[model samples]
Target: MLTLPSIYVLDICVFVFKNIDKFTRVEDTHNVNTRHKKRLCAPFSRTKTLSGSPYYMAVKIYNKLPNTFKTEKSPTLFQKKIKQYLIEKCFYSVKEYLEFCPK
Candidate 1:
């Protein structure tokens, strides 16, 4: 059966957190860090598909926000420019996250 190995999940979380400035209020670095720690501390379980996984659930929740929410993917050049501007405004405050692996 196909499943997302824990390493891939950690990488995705790191990527998401790093680029989180592109998305509005969906998650902060602290929140993502906390969730990552939770996942690391929890026991692993097999799932039938990646879509049923926690990562997918988090993405789904983020996508469900009202249209007013600013996400990395915008429909137009103007919106993209706007998003970039917003991200630049706060990028300095963001910190890098270290990836963790299970033994």
Candidate 2:
């Protein structure tokens, strides 16, 4: 799939899964009952084409972002920064991004 070349999309998400706190500020929340308050995550579209894939959604979202969010820091830092940037823009992690994108 074309998305394979653009692995950053999956990398960014995997990073988010590995380090969810960095994105949600779960540490900052004051909730006592729940452990964390998840942000407004969007599920990957389920259409027939690549347009429904998380790769497509991620690329589309990244392309639309401003330069301010396009920092070239370390891979770890870059992921964290991108997470914050996306959250600020109201773009959440893929709610149900399966292991592979369907055709």
Give each model a TM-score.
Answer: 0.24, 0.33
* Model 1 lowest lDDT segment of ten: 93-102
Model 2 RMSD in Å is 12.7
Tell me how many clashing residue pairs each candidate has.
0, 0
Question: lDDT of each structure?
Answer: 0.36, 0.44
Tens digit per residue, CA lDDT, model 1, 14-52:
444455554433233246644233122222347657656
Give candidate 2's whole-model lDDT. 0.44
* Candidate 2 structure quality by residue, lDDT tens digits, 33-74: 543233313344566686766545554444333444443546
lDDT: worst 10-residue window of model 2: 94-103
As a TM-score, model 1 comes out at 0.24
Which residue runs does candidate 2 get wrong by more than 4 Å?
Answer: 1-48, 86-103
